[model samples]
Target: MPKDTILVVDDSPTEQRLVAAALSLQGYRVITAADGEEAIEKAAKELPRLIVLDVVMPKKNGFQVCRQLKTTAATQNIKVLLLTSKSQDSDKFWGMKQGADAYMTKPFTDGDLVANITKLI
Candidate 1:
């Protein structure tokens, strides 16, 4: 079977590049978007199997993006994994409420990130 593609959305070019490379190392195709607008557009256009989104981005945040993706018919079924710095319990609860499948804080290990992606795929 072919490896699934992952759409990674983050404002920091450094973060985006790091994640893209890590996922690529696992043999999955990686696509990137700089902000929430691009993330939404790419999610619709690419329809990736999963999305790795960062919170606290300009224009829109991960929570809003997750809700939008879940509410939209075109991208409703796609799994969303929020990778952000929001560590509070309430933040995680809100993320789930917004329809994300998984939420992880920043400074996560590559193994955990890849493991989450693998499990979801």
Candidate 2:
């Protein structure tokens, strides 16, 4: 069976690499975007099974990206998992309000990441 494709979006190269590595280890095909604009473009073109999106980024933030993805017909069905350092209750609420399928904070374990991806996909 073909592995599921997941788009990992984050401004930090380190974060991107970490997330991508974790997903790849789980047998998922991983694509990456450095910023929100790239993320939106990639998500629209690649139509990955899920997107692990960071909330803080240049050009546009994760909330903006998620809102756009959820509203746009081409990308609306793509599941978005917001991953960021913003762990406040309000941030979680806003992320969900923007149409994220799941919200996970940074400093997460690889197991937790896989678990969330497994559940989302």
Candidate 3:
């Protein structure tokens, strides 16, 4: 099988690196973007199998990006998994409403991240 890729999108460098490191160690290729615009750019170019997006970001934000991706034929098939500090059910609902395939809260276990990605990718 072909290798799978994940795009980690977060304005926080620490969060981006943490997710990338954890996912990379699990044998997946990890790409990163600092914010929503960058996430869109990278997703268009890289065509990653999945995206780990953060909710609160400068510029377009994760939900907006997810919507754009889902609506765009070129990028619509790429799965989006929202990774954010937003813990409320409303947040999860909005994430899904915006086309995210999954929603995971911040400080999530590496096992959860890996497992979700495993299922999606």
Residue 86, candidate 1: alpha-carbon lDDT = 90
Q: Which regions of candidate 3 fall more than 4 Å away from where they truly are? A: none
User: Which one is best on lDDT?
Assistant: 2
- Local accuracy of candidate 1 as per-residue lDDT tens digits, 19-41: 89889989988999999999999
Output candidate 1 Cα RMSD. 1.1
- Residue 15 of candidate 1: its Cα lDDT? 87
RMSD of each: 1.1, 0.8, 1.3
Using all chains and alpha carbons, the TM-scores for the candidates as numbered come to 0.97, 0.98, 0.96
Rank by lDDT, descending? 2, 1, 3
lDDT per residue (tens digit) for residues 51-89 in model 2: 999999999999999999999999999999999999999
Indicate whether candidate 1 or candidate 2 has the larger lDDT. 2
Residue 14 local lDDT, model 2: 98
Order the candidate numbers by TM-score, best to worst: 2, 1, 3
lDDT of 1 at 119: 84
Clashing pairs in 2: none
Best by TM-score: 2
